[model samples]
Target: MKAAMIFDMDGTLFQTDRILEASLHDTFQLLRDEEKWEGDTPLETYRDIMGVPLTDVWKTLLPLHPTHVHERVNDVFQDKLIQNILGGMGALYPHTEDLLSYLAERGFPIFVASNGYPRYLETIVEYYALDRWIISSYSIEDIDSVDKGELIRKVKADHHLSHGIVIGDRRSDFKGAEANEFLSIGCAFDFSQENELREADVVVDDLIEIRDYLEKVK
Candidate 1:
């Protein structure tokens, strides 16, 4: 059977923790400058919410804050994040390019199925010149849904893929793949906890493991 591989961006293909931390700090500073919020919360506190939706982060951070203000904060944060990435502030995970090239050279269809906004994903892909290796892509905006499972299903349908695998670094990524009937591979080298990685069909600590898994499956 032919198999395809879908990957998540943030904590999967790229280790953006430091860059994300800086962006959130800048975002909060922007909010403070605009007199939108005056809280004692630090950037580290928001780090845990990085891979999830921005509104979810706002809800968790400022539950009592007004909805409109929360939306505005997310908007500002997204804008700042784009600017930061465009200014050469982040990097791809170690061996990311190697992995993508390995898969592409083997004639395995590869695409990115991420929870990030389409524009941001596009920017990152273009910045890294990853389009040459990635055959297709999908994002949260394309599905009009934040649920990763639904996004995965949409990607599968769009690509006309009957069987595929998902590689990511979060529990939700694994859950989404399982929910959509795809084999899930967790990348422990990124930043997921043991329990989260356990949700995947397979857990890989390095790109070598991913390559091995693909070979075995093929």
Candidate 2:
């Protein structure tokens, strides 16, 4: 069987940071209005928490807040994120569509493994028409697990995949593939720190490079 491709949504395929800033601003405003948050913003930026699970994101941003507060923030942030996505406030990275089409044409089965919420994942796939190229997508919300490695195992079993590659811009993505004994291709042009992708089997500077590398290896 052809090797499948599992992608991470945030910094790998979808340019989430583009929409997240606006959504975060709105969420902070709402929280202030309702007296849920004390300050104008959290000490750390969203970039600092990128590629981690949502619960960890909450822990990082609201270390002193309770579970209910985190849930409330998540709800508001997700609402705003979906609105921005539908409104065309974000985009896939340059050459991403072309790369996906290239892989699709070669009969590579593509899937998404993300830490995003259910509605957030649905909106992204539908709005971007990613279902056209992707065989299926899975998120932490779907599996009720924070570990991307476990998430990868679930996808592989459910889809009956035997061989595959993991692609993303973070250490979690590389670690997931490593745990599954699959090759990992890290996208270096996105949100990850310089050393974050050191463990990746391969590193790429652009989306088109992914296509080129895969073609040579396939």
Candidate 3:
């Protein structure tokens, strides 16, 4: 592939917030009785940490908890999240499949780069049949740094891509692309809020618009 279209999975492709919140809450309940859990199960504080790794997420959610406890909660959270997705609890954004098919048929090299775990990313791709279009997937679990920029660069270099675009819904995604001087398109419809995507090269409200926009730029 000469160029790749790297996309983020969570808010950009999968409509995951609502379903994931439920999974987080469910996992918290399992970790501690409802009465003792003290903090809000579906803590809105999580809103700012969407693109972070789960290990850090657990620390942020429960600083007083031990590492073992955090690990246990993360394990259960992943399990619950996988179950929720398997049960058809989450849905993809509108036109996501059609757009993927359109890009694939046109021979655009596509990849999903996320901060999510390997299993979770696989589950989403398999569940939504996105594996048909995506050439590969990458996650923070595969990297030593929580910084997605490094992962983004690896995807770009490993594919021998001299020109590529990154599409995502977080500040880190925008920063990654900007840091590497790659084309960046920020999705404004999902988790991205109030200038969160200010660093992006371009921003679009509808996912389908990406195809149109890219065609013009190309």
Per-residue lDDT of model 1, residues 61-100, tens digit only? 7787799988887787778778888888888877888888
Best by TM-score: 2
* Model 3 residue 45 CA deviation in Å: 0.9
Clashing pairs in model 1, backbone N/Cα/C closer than 3 A:
none
Q: Which one wins on lDDT?
A: 2
Q: So what's the TM-score on candidate 2?
A: 0.95
Q: Estimate each model's TM-score.
A: 0.92, 0.95, 0.94
Note the clash tally of each candidate: 0, 0, 0
Best-to-worst order by lDDT is 2, 3, 1
Q: For model 2, what is the C-alpha lDDT against the true structure?
A: 0.87
Report model 3's TM-score to 2 decimal places: 0.94
Whole-model Cα lDDT per candidate?
0.81, 0.87, 0.85
Q: Which segments of candidate 2 are over 4 A away from where they belong?
A: none
Q: Is candidate 1 or candidate 3 better by lDDT?
A: 3
